[model samples]
Target chain A: MARVRERAKMRSTVRAGSGAAARGPRTLYDKIWDAHVVRDYDDGSSLIFVDRHLVHEVSSAQAFEGLRRAGRTVRRPDLTLAMPDHNLPTTARTGADGRRLPVADPQSAAQLDALARNVAATAIPYFDATAPEQGIVHVVGPEQGFTLPGSVLACGDSHTAAHGALGALGIGIGTSEVEHVLATQTLRLNRSRAMAVRVDGTPGFGVAPKDVILAIIARIGASGGIGHVIEYRGSTFDAMSVEGRLTVANMSIEAGARAGLFAPDERVFAYLKGRPMAPSGAEWDAALAQWRTLRSDPGARFDKSVAIDATAIAPSVTWGTSPQHVVPITGRVPSPDSFADPVQREAAARSLEYMALLPGQRMEDVAIENIFIGSCTNSRIEDLRAAAAVVRGRRVAAGVRQALVVPGSGLVRRQGEAEGLDRIFREAGFEWREPGCSACLGMNPDTVPAGERCASTANRNFMGRQGPGARTHLLSPAMAAAAAIRGRLTDVRTLMAEAGMGETQMGEAQMGETGA
Target chain B: MTLIRVEGRAYPLGRANVDTDMIIASEWLKTISREGLGKGAFAALRHDPANVFDDPAFAGAAILIAGENFGCGSSREHAAWAMADMGVRVVIAVSLSDIFASNAFKNGVLAVCLPADAVAHLLDAVRGGAGIAVDLEAQAVRCGGRTFAFAIDAFRRRCLMEGLDEIALTLADAEGIAAHEGRVAVDAPWLAMAGRRA
Candidate 1:
């Protein structure tokens, strides 16, 4: 019809110069955000289009039910992906045919069953527990290349900020917001301010990206990034691997930031070159050209700026419940009197009571009952290799209770096995488990028992997060491996030194390389 | 959503950094239904026999007064759902987490952020068994006949007053969204996939 032809012409005209015309110098977040804004309201809210929607089991059942109740279908089924991660048991046994056995917990089984039915009815692509690509929502997004640079992605899980490391504007949404996006492939949001967290100098020996982010959270406190989108910059982030960058961006939510991103470069392009969901042929060329331009201008302005010296950051570990209750590995537990803020002091006292620690107690002397080196935060291939390096010939201490090494994705698990990292961990008294959000939160069967203390690589350490009355101390993969070896919170640098592994030697270590 | 004008006895829950886990434990999230969450709203706190939620005087209170940074952990909307299920209409605190505040607004629960001193005064008065009142249109909270003005985003205020959810507001701009989607279909073909089977 004539009307259809007229609309086509109008769309072509709008497409000609919409995203190509450069208005002025702008931050990376601003450029991507402005390009995606469909409409701006008078109240400073905008309807922004979402390029990808990742859904998991724990928080998405209600959202899909909302859609069903409203008699609506997913507007963009092609863009939405689902997986059952939170409730998947890591220790699930397989039958003779290699199919996973039924989940033991009735509630967890029902959650997964609901997810399967929802995905089946909606026709959205899903990686079930038996699927090879099944993993944590955040991990699977990047592994499959569904998370692209210069894109806008969202999910119901809070750690969705992990995808922002690829230069995407990633955000966490509630069930209501998830329903909104499902019915219409857009979100009503108020733009967040831009913040720059610049990391200068090079990271020292045994210092990982996890340590840098934990140190940053400690410096800024939990609520410092309340309404901002942080951009991690400077040479330190530039030199980090894509996996390391993911680790840093994964914990941005702990700092209360909406998202965290890094400018796309060769590292990003290299990581996405032949990914399953990446572009190909001429589309790849065009995508690369556009992604190359997705960076902060030389003189872009930010609402707030924080500079951190990477060299000054040691192997950081959280001694209390909050992510901000962190200290260097060599430091002692903080006294309540050291806290000037009454709220912080009270929080410290409560955390101390829950953790059963005394003031001025040495951090290295704190014994741990469990060690969990897996989560969306640090369960990537690089993180596994780092832990493997520390536990190459070392044995888990006798006093320690249990140690779990869970991969982030099936692909990462396969890669680790190929590189013999799994064998190393198992030989060192760790249980190599299947990939899922195991032991991250207590949603699955893998949990720290009551009255136990764990050194975890997960982002959160809230009360009852892992299990009721279970205490958690957040640390990096290497630090967790060191703790498992010493039966206490020990510094990885000191362990490396004791093992005659120097800083220069670790610098030459590469992922998947044997005999480090 | 409904136009909320809460006037009832307020329960004093003066705890700083009260996270979502304390509000509603993860074990309670297994059910798809939002009902029955009131039974487990403050499961951990209720473990203590002396907790205020179980006290005879505050049995059916509709308002909760808490300390700073209430609802600081997790993006679980269950925290808000549980509060609403427990007949809590207003939560007065010094500060609220960004996600929790939005969740409370969408679920017909009003999260009021006042100055620390005002929250302290409200806490004291509520502990003394004073009835509290909150007016969305006036952006004010009154306790023991003393009114304290609070600040809220004008858009959120209008939404609360008009009982408008995001979907309703978004539907008002349906034509604009249609036009934008049409343009995006040509501008970025990759993002326009709706019916393409994966």
Candidate 2:
């Protein structure tokens, strides 16, 4: 505690001496990025310091081996945190007897074992499979408060943008860059152009952060954000909770953006107030004061700007392999002939064939075999509660082959169980599994069968991302629950109406349809 | 990185939005080794026996012409590794994802950006069995005597030409980094001890 207080005090003092007030108008990314530049190169590249580094099992093994081969140690092992999530089985083997199951896949077991050995040898902080904090690296970073406001965080995984919800500059790096950071604690990168995506008004009923992000991706195609960092602004983001903001930022990469962030606010401060790694007492106040200055100044210039009306966004689902190939849940599948771009038209034809959908078929009519309601994108307690509310007294539809709900982390699992959310899921015929990245990338035992269609709450919808030859439609937790209940891609609003859960109970705004 | 000008038959795999996941599926990422990835390159498309990578016409091609936003998904360096493994030295597209371009450069592969029209012309030439040549020194690509210029960062071009990796670049300024660290140790002792044991 003394050390923590001293570090906080030192940070506070440093901020006092720096020219914080006299700086010109700057975007949130600009502010955090400028603070972390250790050296700037003449060729528009800089060796920027990374405050925190998150690592996972699948991508870090080679990086650690590279470090070993070079006869060098981690430059800052204390700042690095490791965990195994991608290759773990979500199902329990003891059948309620609580006997832990050994990992059955030899390859997965070997990956985890290598990670364990690497962490132990380097003395880096790690959360093992049995550790309470074990979870996806993106989820664990924010929950542990290692992703503090105004810090720069990097990870080998692409969803590291999820950390940007706390007003930090979070970036995804490749294995080679991971090794670079491990040896030098800095990344040499060329600065990216700045973009502002301003969303206003309230979202409609059944519309979620997932819908808003998907709608954004639909409006601006996958390549719209190339070579840029996006800042999500305006009233809708202001009204959203930190969890919702995280979901939106998590998929920024899907639109080809380097990173996405929301400015810190009172809600952000409240969320981090007592997190395990958050500062305490005077240190908290000092950090809050610093965070308050992290927002964008009025009239800050952005290279590109886009405006979105949140009321126009509906419950969305992807019809094609790319996240940009999404349509409103109530809409019909688009004909490839409708696309003006030749490339998009060809891609659409391929996607339609792979998805086995007709051009004029209603999205709600598309049958689904599996429903996955967990991932780093939407596996928090709030996500679970939203899903539980939809499945409280319901049963899975007859044709729905499987319904699985895996929490984001053990802590999230315990919280949901305390609230009886797990019971609600199980009673509704949904399998309540332990926390890990289950079926998100299908790197483990939990996989969507080949040639089957699944409604998933994960971020990406690329071809075979969930499993070999598996078709995935990305949606929200509530929408996944509705699909499980209807055995098709049904809108949550219609299900809520059937359940007599009025719009007020849904706690989401309602608006008329605005055509895509 | 050896600065050998690429001159060979080019494969026209001009599909847009070809993400890294399509290049190499996540299922193939369990192995720590970067070997044998060439077999998995374009695995999804390879399922079709007539895919360009496997077509006898494009076999042993060192250049690939792809559509816009090539390699857009995931931060997997395996995408670049797979291309390198398959003996692809250059990829010409309308644009490349930032991470993918960086990975390609690090793995000794060249990612060249051209206008959609230029890419289309190249695709036509490749379909006609004409050879493609990329001249880094001239920053131009030639196809059947038609020259097209492409822009590249001078520093990156120099690194590619000189076979310099990031480690070598950083080591070039090792003395400067040490001096900066020494200054930071005094100015912010807390940050200096961030990675040090108490």
Candidate 3:
């Protein structure tokens, strides 16, 4: 009761400080929107300032070309960070003599060259392929503290939503929006309606953070987050480390959300404190005071609210093409008739046919030939450690043709190597590779073969996402490692029991200072 | 963007939750330019003999019709560019993804959302050799003696009819952006601290 009263006082204080005409109670989205809105248009859209921009290769080439076509320079080059990820090879980037090897794929080389030239021409900071900081844009942003609380961050890649885990308003944009941000440093856009997803109970043992998000997506369905920016709240997110929160938030796009966000807290402050780009000294103190206020007021209203029982979430995996077609690892593949709607039922039937599974087939009986334990979603040090725990003493199943572990960033790779995870994976017969979004989207040489099944930690399981006719079952890193061990979709609980490892052990991979 | 009205035989490929990856493959995205994406549009779907996107009757369709959550995944604008390159001027769906809608709008393609019944009705009409028309000026979709009204943001509607470059339009408000940056410098000076160069 006293806590409620304190929240009420805080709401009133927030209203008083905000220059807006005293909004009653504002959600975190509202507060961020109000702070960044530059000018409101007559059409109910506003030009909101973007504080940071991360530019990558695949979706940014046309955007830079657009800037050149219009003869416009980057409005705020300091606010922009550029790197190549989508097309770069995850294999060794340097040759035997330590000189950078030329990208084998001509198209990938051209795209990378375009990004390098664009960043060079505009004077925006860039990390080359061999740079320690070069990695997935979404992974690189928060690692360097380039993504901060209450700021708007835009990137051409959809996984830009990952930054929202740090309490920043991260928006994924198309090439056109990228061009707009490059030229104006502001997006002329309407604010997305707010949706809050609060998890109430504790996750059971063996249920990884990846399972939590997959469960949320399954519960909400594919388009549940359309036209909305979802806020991750409740005890679950509060307990989740920055890496875990990032894994969840990165996949929000798969739910069709404009972005996924969390309110800034002490954990966030500790994560950002002493980073390369984070403010230091007195400025850090000032930023901390302001960041502390970047939360939703009590009694704040959201356009939609979803509640999930965390205990109900099991180590989950997608049996079909879409992310929404997820089921617990212990469950059986469902029949299309199970869906009440004709459209969903039809889609299910098509997916089932494509996946070559019968309606009542046991998920564990479904054999997977490949395993991918990395992507923007589950490629952090913690994720790598979780997979390592499952693979520590075991060898990859003979039926499992290939299992690959690619870290999210170069630093994450080095961190995993430092912790001796590379040895565990390599000893388990898993290919421990460099970072660069390997086999996740199949843009590079590391593609899963057609007519094969893969248990991937990547967010999307869309048909042909891994490769044409490559069936992907999305699961947690531990679950993927378990699948690699079993050569089929198996429950991670039994494996966790075998390893005597609790889920809590997965959360121990610490990211101290970047340079430290 | 000059797309006030688009009248054509709507391609009846009404699959729900059509992802951008399904529309265009990742291999096709490694281009520095946006042109020549039509060949790769629905490349995966076209590999299936039963896929309706390659139906002879719907070849070079100026308007495409689909079910809800169309363009559900990925923020890649190549989906929109590919559709436009295929001569698609409008996409009518039960509902459209937010990023897809913005991308389509910026690339001179109209994304119109209507009720499921209306979309189903239009799909049936188009499959039966009837031409459908999306009139942005009237804010309505007309086909086979029936019309369905749609709601679109006025600014987006204006941008479609007038076809203004969005960057040029936003640059006109430079004063407003500068003013906001000035306020940030005073209120939160730490926010502007960028990382060191490599």
Candidate 4:
């Protein structure tokens, strides 16, 4: 009894340690980080206590298989959740691969089979591809309220930062880490130094959350934010809605941060209020009362700080192989020497070689063979509407091989179709497919033909990611749509003007479309 | 579960940016079993037929000498499972993409991280039959009789060297948990009963 009480006392006291009670106070990251610090090592790594672990078909399979091989069961299966999206085809099919073909592809079938076997073998609660609730693992976790504020969430997906919108410090894990978490519920990780990326001022019209994040990634090269957890702050972040915040956090990994987070605010509470996994009634009210206090305190310290002006950010596009290879749509390809470092300049030169473009060329003039405006990164309803607004009256360029729109979730798909977003996409010659990670990783049937260039809304443009020898340029949904119509990298701002359809402010217009 | 140091053979991939799709291609998704995954380990490599795995260059190697960002995509445990199945005991890379390294460790594959220069040296040593003995207990690698240190998160090393999965760790505390539950059941029978009702 004394031992338990002593441990409890240590837990409570530690919560107030590390400047949490100092005059300068603690950042939200610090508070959450402290709360989850199960054990601290001399070398500065932490045995982080994970509150929630989200898994998916591809990554969870082997961890469960590992458990079975060891004659063990899932230790805290109740705290674990699973969903399969990566290899699940968008269209429903007769065979098990979930493809719409007369015959199911054996490889895709095997993925589903292994997922089912693992779930059944370990009794892990799963949302299979055939389940109505199944969607991208990142989207499902937050929507189901499985992600809560002040908790440490880990997933095998890099975009696990999508859950960081709840104010949790989420981390992406590898298969062994997944296995580690399954066995120990603790990950041996080196804690990252915190960096506050403060985006001040209001965004201009026609600029969306994707633009804001793309702008941030452009400022911080693809690896600039490496080895840090970025805590996003300031008026621009305050102005974004829950979904908008998720959009920002989702791309944090693309910028090379372990995770990205926004301090919980009224918008977060409003979104979580009646969610299935959220607290209820009196519990909800109490949770809200506590959540209201979960922000970085005044004068909190950050290891590094960067201030970006929201007004300075514009709709952006990538001209090379990485998310860092970006410039404002109005800007031209940069001179390699302008990179300021020979290494980066050399990397830029190599990227240019693969892209088959010369430095100093206008970005807008680069012709594209395909335009894909979907992926977990930018496939929510607002993303769809943004693309729809651009393609409502425009037809895709004739030579474009594939112009596709894939919603992130079934809920998003239903909502988009209800609002006629699908009609606008189809009218503009875009393939409106069912919800799944299509063309996101080229696991499913949707792939860019070899050696072609595609303007995509998906994150990551590493070599051969979209398809074998296929080149990708990551952009926002609207920009992708604009490129689809013009057969080149056309700025959405130019298309919005040409179409005479005004753009919506980031959160003000979209948060109004919430399910509640 | 014993910390037995084994000087496993090493294979050199010498490739950079190996994506998950290449580790275990999308076509092998049909079976629920991981039994034969290693046979198809480098399916994408076999797609070309003349790739390194089949070439005479690094025959009988048990280690994989790879480039940076060795596993850089979706967190597919199959990739790690495939590598383990293919008799790859150690994967030495200058740097590993975070997710891939973690996955590799959990599946009983050693993902060793060395500086770029150190990795190049290790690669040259392995090719020359200077067997690298991976000591999980010491968290060090002995190549050509020279002990060079590599870092592993101590907790992960404990789990891997013991071959303990997550459940085993949790179950290790099962007695403490049951005692706590017993106390909770006595103090808050309603809560205990509530669990049963659910």
- The sequence of per-residue lDDT tens digits that candidate 2 reaches over residues A1-516 is 665566456544544444344556878888887666666777767777777898888888888898898887787787788888888888763446666567888878888888999999988898888788888888888887778888889998788888888987899988888888888888888878899999988787788888889988898889998899999998888888788889999989888899998999997899887777666676667678778999888978899999999988999999999999999999999999999989899999999998888898999999999999999999988788777878879999999889999999889988999999999999989999888999888788788888899999999888889887899999999999999998999999888888888655554421222232
lDDT (Cα, tens digit) per residue for candidate 4, span B1-198: 334366756665655455566687554544446567887677656756666688666666667877655675555666887888777767877666666776776677778777766666777787776667877778777776567788777766776777765545555655544443444333222222211111
Query: Best by TM-score, which number?
Result: 3
Name the better of 1 and 4 by TM-score.
1
Give the Cα error of residue B124 in candidate 1, in Å. 2.7
Question: What's the residue-level lDDT of B166 in candidate 2?
Answer: 80
Q: Could you give me the TM-score of model 1 versus the true structure?
A: 0.94
| lDDT of candidate 2 at residue A371, scale 0 to 100 | 93
Q: Ten consecutive residues with minimal summed lDDT in candidate 3 chain A?
A: A507-516
Residues A205-312 of candidate 3: C-alpha lDDT, one tens digit per residue = 777888889988998888999999999998777777898889889988888899999998888899888878888888889999999899999999899999997768
User: How many residue pairs clash per model?
Assistant: 0, 1, 1, 18
Question: Residue-wise lDDT of candidate 1 within A1-516, one digit each (tens)?
Answer: 675678668654643434424546689998888777777667777788888899888788888898888787788788888998887899855888887699998988998899999989998998888788888888988888888898899898778889988988888887888888888878888888999999877777888888889989988778788778999998888778888889889889888888899998898899977777876677678788889999999888899999998879888889888888999999999998898978788889988998999999999999999999999999998889888888999999998888999999888999999999999999999999999999988888888998899999999898888989989999999999999999999999888998898654453232111121
lDDT score, residue B94, model 2?
Answer: 96
**What is the lDDT of every predicted structure here?**
0.84, 0.84, 0.87, 0.72
The chain B TM-scores of all candidates, as shown, are 0.89, 0.90, 0.95, 0.77
DockQ of 2: 0.44
Per-candidate interface C-alpha RMSD? 3.0, 4.1, 4.4, 5.9
| Candidate 2 CAPRI assessment class | acceptable
